[model samples]
Target chain A: MKRFIFLLCLFLPALSWAQLTIQIQKGADKPLSVAIVPLAWNGPSLPEDIASIVGSDLKRSGQFAPLPSGNMLSMPHEASEVVYRDWRALNVDWLVVGKIVPMQNGYTVQYELFDVINQRQVMLDREVGYNDSLRDVAHAISDKVYEKITGIRGIFSLKLLYVSALRDAQGQNTYRLMLSDADGAREQILRTQREPLMTPNWAPDGETIVYVSFETRRPAIYMENLRTRARQQLTNFPGINSSPTFSPDGRKLALVLSKDGNTEIYVMDVATRELTRLTNQIGIDTEPAWTTDGRSILFTSDRGGKPQIYKVSATGGNADRLTFDGTYNARPRAMPDGSGFVYVHRESGDFHIVLQDTKRGVTRPLTQASLDESPSVAPNSAMLIYATLYGGRGILAAVSVDAGSRYLMPSRFGDVREPAWSPFVDRR
Target chain B: MTYKNLGLSLGVVLAMALAGCSSNKAADSANQNGANSGLGSNSSSTFDPSANGNGSNLAQNGRIVYFGYDQATLSSDGQSVLDSNISALKSGSQHIRLEGHADERGTREYNLALGERRANAVLQYLVANGVSKARIETISYGKERPADVGHDESAWSKNRRVEIVLN
Candidate 1:
């Protein structure tokens, strides 16, 4: 089977690290405070800093606040070497001790998670990958540690796609659709267009990504495979062909095209390229996102005279208004658990991310940002990343599902927007 | 002689850093430079010192009609601008491109639809004023193209406009 992991370089290498600076505004009230004891390195050198990766992963989730490496009193390479008393004195909930041994073919990362109160080892597992892929191995270790503690699968290994824009000194605007690690590292540019690029979405199978580009001097949908780097123009109709979203099954793509008339939703088969018109509203029916079950599509329509989140059957029918509390609610992204969805909710002239519980009939704002858009829920539905303005500069930020913790992924150079966190990839 | 064409190239410098892999883009931009040099010189010679902006000033000139926040309908000022363009819009020899835009507010996709609606409103207005529908083509840049880079209303009102480009 072909894995969707990116191991190829078809574009000039993009920058790494330092681009997305993290600022932890808040986190879970009772964050599982832990100490990540610096691991003993047994290699000539290391391509990846495993300890920092794991620590950042845990901290980014807003679940665990790792003790700074400088504060760790003892640097234990193994659980047997760990002084449990030292951690208990620090009042840390857990202690993570690890070691890296260089193998002839690759390297083995052996890590152990210990419960401070119980005074016992909880997780002891080893992952082996080529030294070149140590970053992936580190993320795999983070996933294990996270699941062991929270009982929820971790999404540290998944990828995130976003668009960044910069105005060159030559008086021209430059845009880039970038792919990066969940921690905002190893950014790779997928495509470059002179006009504008918008709304990058992932295919359910995790193989290809769809986005709207004005390369042809008009808004049209395009898809590019992550593995092959092959691109194909999906739609080039007369009018607009924007907001392309892959259906839950990955067999179809529901998008907004203004060919037949005003902006409306249409689904096209992936293989045959056959089109199925979904919404036929003259008023505006755009931003078509499918529910997890694939039976219905949630979109934003202005047919009622105000932009509101509405749901229509996949085949086409009446669109029931799902949001009423706010005067403006657009960009509805369905969570994986079938429990309502998230969208940009505008109130008092400030726009924030809000989660609407479909079954419970309750909606609450999750972000306090005055200007936020393009919210993408992680594969595990535990967190989401969206674009918002920070100090007049556009940046990407993440918020936990319960609105417990938040972090801003601020780009150092230009404005960043339209972030689409990838679906879960490493099922192993 | 009445007005010098301010002659801005409007850079179209939209760069998508799809990375340096675009080895042909250098060549493409070179060719674009060659093709636009004539227009550049023509406008430079007719340069009106009073006109502001050094970049794509097409949208900044009087050809654009501003709109209210979030509303696609035309205001009297906007209508008057289009009213002044009636003679030119009715000229069978001219092809008009109505490029709609929006302020940096709301979701990008929704703003795109709104921009399209705004453009269509302009197209409908022109058609009602005796301009042939076949002579006009419309596209919405959403909030991508801004006349002014500022985030306040002064910048937004100018960004939220429809530009009538004649070719």
Candidate 2:
């Protein structure tokens, strides 16, 4: 009986790993055509098709148009297989081929990238993973191929943290904090509660997450270690406690608190729990985010009578208004490159995610969907995921930073929002 | 106006208020009367927000005040609801908890601040009307806890509110 229960427990998580459906709305005007051939397998039949996963990852970026496997004239696993003429004939700019060989306990995946036009091998690499982790191995190969072809780091291996809520017939909501791969696969529920959960963000190290929860019938900030599943309530102030963002170094957290009579920006040391008040204006100051260098914080404030993005030094000082193009702009998220920031801008009563290039003094809207908010950019700054109302349901959507690609990730269960894209972490 | 006349006017205003919203009318009317009669003469027999309900249920109803979108200021209707409770709030020994909420429209964190501003508005009004500051506690739930889950204006109007919990 114990062994049967153990097996059931081990398999239940796999059975419950529901994936979000991806609907590509738009792609680049001239996406590079690439072909990822089926990786030849020399082992027991694997449950996952590694090549297909890699192909999907690359195609989802909107920078590449993966060729259908049926269109491929020949499948070459190595550079020596030649036959470059076949790929050239297919009008494929890039080609990827690999093979999976089973070892005693794991599998070895060897993949090679080729420039069909140049007829030259671009990259050759191998990765090893256990039976259950073939997906990760495939993602690593995708990352390598994406980087080699585009000269930009890939975000396929990154994870996403978001909140999913389902309202029952009684109108009571059940909220779940969910984690999944950037492609919306390998989903895992981090926490579930009867109360609402909001503003979940990852620490820079990717080992800890901080979020606001109303589990105590009052909003409070909490942090949980991912690897150990250790949970700790970080703040339980008298009033609103929310929008906790980790500093780039992960040693401090910038958040908003109303305990001091009005909502104001504050920073807390992660180690000693010491607090430092940063803003003293009577306006509603909240949604504090750190700059890439950790020297300043960008936040939302209404001191000027409408919500707008503002910036202040990390230690505490006067804030300079950062947005002026819109009457209502709030929830500023600094881009990974520090060249610009992304925020919610109200345009003709519809809220859309807009990217502000600080250096160029130019602003661009990354999403056309109405009611778009809570944008979290990938570590590589190539793409961003945000929550948008689609068909009256709150679903997650992704758009490339340059506004070339767009896709929606609607879950099978309920409303999903507040997508926080994870930083790149070493899986090995 | 006489206490009875005041109760009658408040009741009429509350009925119109309840009629304007698409939520549960019976519940809103009952609560509206309960909020109005808390400070006036305890003769809740004639001014019950509900048609068939008595004074016993008055304390539980009428504790919520609605607001406009992205607004933290108290509406005249909200002020009337509070004005009716002035005596009861000033004399009551129970702690007053003002829980603020916002509709699911804008960003969550900004809504948090907006909710706080709404609750603080109510707190300032109570303090200005002779209620001790020590008797009240305020908290903002932002858009997290929506009284009405619908996405339209009818629901959003109902969700943007402050509930007075006497404990």
Candidate 3:
């Protein structure tokens, strides 16, 4: 009987190991861990650090948590120098390292990603070009790493358009509509005005932007093609034409207009310029944002006596209020999954970012910082970028939806406001 | 009285006028109290200028009008004053510039629209009262200038008004 029991115990262990193998084969497990070592630089101090930015782009996706450089046994600048044993000892599933070398036209950034456990180099890359191309190269590397690990595309190559404000001596307000890399590098100003310009939203294809500007001393919506620098004013209504947002398919624009006695939401056909009023109410209805499916819109209205989030069908219907916990909740940006939305919620008179689950009707406070506003979600729905006041200066900040990752993009110029996260850019 | 004392008193008067020139609070309060005094009402006499600190008095006495948040409609009180002001303007020969203003409630661009609405509301009333529209021109300062320094409700009520300036 004792001999039989001992054999059964040994056999039971083997049976459990077989079950674990089955589970692994069925893809029931966590993702592979990745470690990105700081890249080596051979050129003069770069205009902007590229490796750190790439690492941050990967980290914000929530799929990877970069290990600190101090934990690295040896920093490898080339694929030939990779010591897999060193990374294996640290239990790192993958390793990424590279070096930037000077080139005639610009710079060459050579990088490699290694599967430490497999003892093989997964990605060997060569990005050759100018200083302006470094950011794109970094994004490409990030894309490669992301695809190798998660089997999904990375949106790091996309660009974000935002509004930058400066007050001149003549008491004139100067607004510069700017476009920059997703990592906040390679900033290029698209338009400058002596009046207020706001709500810079990108087109679905990432080639154009639609925003509201007071260039003619009246609130009008304007669309500008980023490549050609051509612009067209969409609305020159007699009263309040503002808060323009593009539909998901880019065929129409959702905007606010008060020409018919009260401010209300309106949808304009991009091709025909025909207008259709969506909301007809006495209260102010503005700040329209389309749902991911483009079937409905979420906007702010004071019909409930205070500013709150309300949802109406894109085809027009009775509006439904979505927020109830706060006295003031505006700027509702829906997540990509249609699962929830993030918006500015007033708590104790200070505005902060809050996430609301649409299905469950549950709200979660994602930020505790004071005065965080204009929260926009990444195309992946993993992170949020918003404009907040830090040290009495306006700066752009990003925070994970789970409240784990946080970072700031402080502009060296004047105040930065109204940061619009671009949709996922398709890489050819 | 000696010339020196008279000159000193005159200097004091000039300083006061300069300081109060831009602020209508002092002048408005004085007028209200002077009206009460003419009725022989010393009972509430010590007349604290700050009692009607809210620009509501400006709207009630036909010197100004108030609008809703992001609105420029003439409230019943605002319409009553405009009704009387139309007759007064028709009798007088002075041309007026209707200066429009808005409270610090909405965005600057929206505020400009609100201010213009307030001015137009009054202009429309005057035109209906047989006053020539050409006699009045309108200008909107939006929320750039405030009649009261406070940021509370009373101050906002006072700031959202249209002042008819005789030119």
Candidate 4:
């Protein structure tokens, strides 16, 4: 369990640290080979695949390589129907089998995970939900199986927010802010405008998200409540009002504003609307992300004459440059554990995602794209997704924290960008 | 209004002389100034400079300015374009919006700031040339509103332009 210090305890009298407590699961490094058989459908219509979601979820974590359905010798829906010798001959370490039965309320999904080497059942779980939320139900089961095996919570239930620029039939480009599942299902449009939207950051509770929208004819940060769909303009500074991120405690926001004549980092208490200036730099100091601890902010700056990750106290002090390996390193997204950070690094004519361990002073590139950007880390710290151009179109791709596993979140339509991974949402 | 006087005072020397003097010398000066005056008509007219055989390019109709890669400061061509837009902007009651833009090469946040810097650079030039601050509003589309969708430098160069949107 991770404990938050309640960074704003002094200012917020009624604040409880319990509400802010969030665990940042360190991802398992050793890859595990697992097999997930296609779930037997008891209903006429199979809205979703519980096995595929669980397989994809586990595969996305960089922890497991799920055997493709075609490669399996037999399809078994339950432990009694399993052929242990066949799976053992296939060299699989773990096996998962499930079946979905349609009920009056929704569907009942029964899944069982087995240790193929031990020839014994490890977990048997059942999940029930409304018919409309079949995708959610699949993710819920994935979460249970993942945590049971990896000892880390699954983030498949968490959603992602991103901006996609698609040209309509009129040949006019329209920008849309979208709310979508991690598995690329049930895409809901939050807002659509001709003007560009950028830099979306999620509030800790996953109830509100703040993003920069140009609908007002200028870049301004707006905080929107997900439940009510109500939005309030947060900042409309004269020069540039963009790049807003919620502090870990959810009490304050760490953002970039140029209202003072130069782009600099600033913080505002969400409740009081009180603004506190952080970095004062002559050069561009933008893209502010709060450290998981909430005591410091990591941001991208060119104070060193080129863009690199820089760190400064959440309250305002001397900014310390954190990167030196590359000529360009910007958009510093600190991991949930604060163990290290992930950033867009430009090296050898390509912009790729890289993870930098602050304590160890080690840097590792996590992607191989020509223009990978807008990396949003999973709540579990197990994986991250970033926007990259594939086949001349913008697409979002995910990679494990260790750069061990990778997959592309299939681009639905148009050019997508600025993926903001939602925090681990509260269970419904 | 004050704008007409300012326009007359700025580069519309012929308009000033035509306003100040008798209509007699105005024809002679118009001939001397050639079609550059009518061809250089600002926001107040339906004249297209391309209509004449001048072949001086679209810069002749000037309200837009272009910049080099990764640069916010205007080039010689950009400065000349702004120089021509001043008189028309002065003569009109319309609010001038300098919509700054950049190529799709950098991060959105940084590009936004860069775009604003480019717009501010143009704003300063207009203010330096006597366009009122109240009559001008600036917005940065950054790389979002690309004039060209191609990925090459040709497309990028076209996208790295600040549109002089006069309303």
Candidate 5:
């Protein structure tokens, strides 16, 4: 049982604090103003601050601007003692107040949301969690509040998967596959190796993951179950074997292989290990990602002399180019609804993450960072996390899909890259 | 006399680094020398110009071949470097591995493919020049491993290269 946590901390050595510090770089031009008053404690002071955590979560989303607690005219823990005029005086459109009550083995956090503009109560909810799980409860509260206001699901409770490489004194590198909360807490390293690992992505089931590892001295695709810790190498081809992405249905894995002489896209049946080559081109055809319906695949190819996103039938067919605006576009991951995708777009020599809406035929860059790449959209499609260089070290940065909110999650040590946001897990 | 010994030690170290046999020390030397000796540099000679007369020195000169941005074709300078080491390559029966690499600019998976393309290009050149196809193997590290850690073009140009490692 003790060995369970060591795997989580193997690559992050000698660091007392391993959590990534979240720095909000930008927010929406006109963010909604909300006040989250500090929750009143009924018993001895708890370890976690529920209201503060919830407020930070909301603020990081870039849609809601959490008002400073110092500016709250009146602190109302319950709806019965509410005062709308006080919140209105501060120009706050929404109000949130909560209180903590210790239970037998855990605590219950009761919170209320009010519409300052209409002078009405929007919601009254309570969450119960143990001491160590208090942060999760806070995220759960934030999810509820955000969904109530935006009519879209919140990703506060989701997980993030990324790879961090730490170079030793000898300049040799050790790569670690890390799993953490969306806000960069509870970091658990699933795999660590001296060789390189890339293109880690979650299965739709949220219990398994696929990534390319050079552990065997060559590129190979590997699948690991997060619960049992069981590992299996899925592809061991002679040439390049990489870019393994699980299909939406979790049945087939779309990947790239150069076994037949050149880089090409292929799909492998997860159960039987059957292979289906999808793209046949002399040029490089790689980075296969499944569309929302799992009926077609989107991949990056240099068939047109420059890397561009192309779409092809999942079974097999001619691929049609999807991106026309950029001379260099690659690594396309479609949105949840198949309405749009996010990819690496090179404009004026700088690589930035851009979102393309297929339904509306509109494309926009979501980040201003010069070297941004590996954009992984959240389960809800509200935000995305990508790898970028900050202060000459690789760090994970996030941006809202609408380009409204921007934040940087810099690790305490080494370089973090290729962040894959997990799907919404059914906690029940 | 001490300078001769130092040169001998550096030659062994450079050989191991070029052969992909040594670890951190080799990578460190690659970083230190790649920028100076890389094809992107205006000066092509890595060591003393007078040392070019020796076979071992010619082999060392041909140990690395750099490429332009998003390019897999061998430049004239690259071809000349390989031509100098052809005698040493043909004389040895040892197998070789061409480790391809790319700078950290594009998507990693694409870079992996690009690196492979570059290695294949090198392999073709060697095979066409009389090296047996079976004697050479190729692997692309993509942008995962870099000859230099710097982010500037100077480092990137050095990183975007194929290393000829003799086993």
Candidate 6:
């Protein structure tokens, strides 16, 4: 009887390991190590692969590092086939294995997460969706897995808006405003013009965009509904009209207009078109960006003898200078957290993007590129996308705030500029 | 009413004759004394010389040249004035700085390049006219620096200028 009991104890652990239970811990000293095995599919080759897309999406977050197949100890297709001891030997805290089985009209995906330390199966998610929705499904799974581990919402479904310019013979320049996935996928042209388009900004709701256009032989601001494709001319003043920014609440727009005899900031109601002047200074007051709270706005002005950032109340009050370090500091875009602002700073005859900490009142250089301009921060404030000249051609590049990861998005048509990251879309 | 009208017309006629006589005398003095004597004095005491052409008021100081919209080509009138000023600087052997500016019509980055091109055009003109390129340096302020506060064509025309300053 004693010999049989010892044998039973040894077999019990092996049985538990095969079940592959995952435990979602509250916090860990470091980010949990996860290994995502390639999905096993028993069907005709699908138009899209979900496993590769999920891996790429998770890796782009910078918080999670997905292990490659070679580093993985065991490739498990089902929950019963997992070897917890192999994964624990590799120091992997979590292991994910999934399979795709073809259904009548679509495909059914079943995935399982295991906790190698506990030697048990923790969670399982199964869904039936179309093949064309594979990327979306992958993003959804990434969000779920990330939130389950990191305790913060993932911005996987957001979008980005940018403007591209192509100059042809006969001196005709074609400008296109494009909308694409946050990862630069599935791009669709929003508007096209033979003239120049500048300063594409997103509304708070993420469904509309405001920008400046020079189609009528003069610069004017316009707002377009992305879904309905309807455009309204926001400003048609006699003089210079540019730099349109939406307020946080989406009820108003703050912009620069020289029709009042000087380039001053103005707040106009989006519905009624009633105007209220904000600044009365005899300086070049342009590039107006609203604070996250919507109580004040930060803009670039030369009132202090050089172009620097100044903040004023949205309802018109005493303006306060915000930047004093560089000889040329302009294009202030407030971060989502309201803790800092990112703008182009010129030092030693080279322009770079720098982050200004509002609390410490100090600026830190973020990029060392020579001519990086027009930086827009992601909705999560983790990365910033901006335009730079690469090999004498304009291209868009993104870099993490810590300068750890960088990527480039070159346009297939022509040069791209003025990238605007949209806020997180409301997922209902 | 009759008295007020008579006084206004009389004031206008008297002002016109006085301005014409003073300009004639100023011209005669300029011919005899040369352009250097007129440098330190206010030229407004004589008739305004920029009334006919779109001459920038900046030229009254004899230290600036203006360009048309989106153009770097020097107008004939602007060239003649800059020629005389360049000759004076060459003869005086003075180091000069040329500050270029642009109107707020294009994007800021493009405007900066445009302003630099305009200033370089002026620099080339000066160098071809026997002025040493080493004696003149150029800095483009782009649209950051504007002399006129308005956004109209009148203001934009005045804002696009290259100011020559002696170092």
Best by DockQ: 5
- Clashing residue pairs in candidate 2 (N, C-alpha, C atoms within 3 angstroms): B31-B61, B31-B62, B35-B62
Candidate 6 residue lDDT tens string, A1-428: 99897567445433321111111112222445788888898778887767666666666665556677888767898888998888888888777789988888888888887777988787798866796677666777776666666666666666778887764321234677777666676566666776567779999889989987767644678998876768899888854577788998999999877676557789999999999999988666878888889999988887786778899999998999988887778888888888889988878866788999887877888777666788888877777888876665567877766656666777665578788888876665
TM-scores for all candidates: the values are: 0.88, 0.89, 0.70, 0.81, 0.88, 0.67
- Candidate 3 segments whose C-alpha is farther than 4 A from its true place: A1-49, A56-72, A77-80, A88-93, A99-110, A115-128, A147-153, A168-170, B1-21, B25-167
> How many Å off is the CA of B74 in candidate 2?
0.7
Higher lDDT: candidate 1 or 5?
5
Better of 5 and 6 by lDDT: 5
lDDT of 3 by residue, A328-388 (tens): 7887888887988888787886678999987787888887766687788888776778887
- First chain TM-score for all predictions: 0.94, 0.96, 0.82, 0.87, 0.94, 0.85
lDDT of 5 by residue, A384-420 (tens): 9999999998999999888878999999988999999
Error of 3 at A364 (Å): 1.1
Question: Of the pair 2 and 6, which is ahead by DockQ?
Answer: 2
Q: Per-residue lDDT of B67-143 in model 4, one digit per residue for the tens?
A: 88768888987888778657767766766677788877777777777788799899999899897889887878777
Docking class of 4: incorrect
**Per-residue lDDT of model 1, residues B1-167, tens digit only:** 00101111231211111111122332244335434443333233211211222222222223667799999999998888678657645864556678899998899999998898899999999999998999888999899866556668866876788866654
Name the lDDT value of residue A366 in candidate 1. 91
Q: How does model 5 fare in lDDT? A: 0.83
A312-419, model 4: which lDDT tens digit per residue?
999898988889887888888888877799998888867898999877888889888788888888878888888887777778888878776677764556788898
Q: Give the candidates in order of TM-score, highest first.
A: 2, 5, 1, 4, 3, 6
User: How well docked is model 2, in DockQ terms?
Assistant: 0.29
Residue pairs with backbone atoms closer than 3 Å in model 6 (clashes): A20-A120, A20-A121, A21-A120, A21-A121, A21-A122, A22-A115, A22-A121, A22-A122
- After aligning candidate 2 to the native by TM-score, how far in Å is the CA of A234 from where it should be? 1.2
> What value of lDDT does candidate 1 attain over all alpha carbons?
0.79
lDDT per residue for candidate 3 within B1-167, as digits (tens), equals: 12222212221222123233323443444334333333222222121122222222122244566676556778887787677556666765656557578865443334544666688788888888897877776655565444542345765776788866543
Candidate 3 chain A lowest-lDDT run of ten:
A17-26
Q: Chain B, model 2, TM-score against the native?
A: 0.67
RMSD of each: 7.8, 7.2, 17.8, 11.6, 6.2, 20.3
After best superposition, candidate 4 residue A241: deviation in angstroms?
1.4
Please say which candidate is ahead in TM-score: 1 or 5.
5
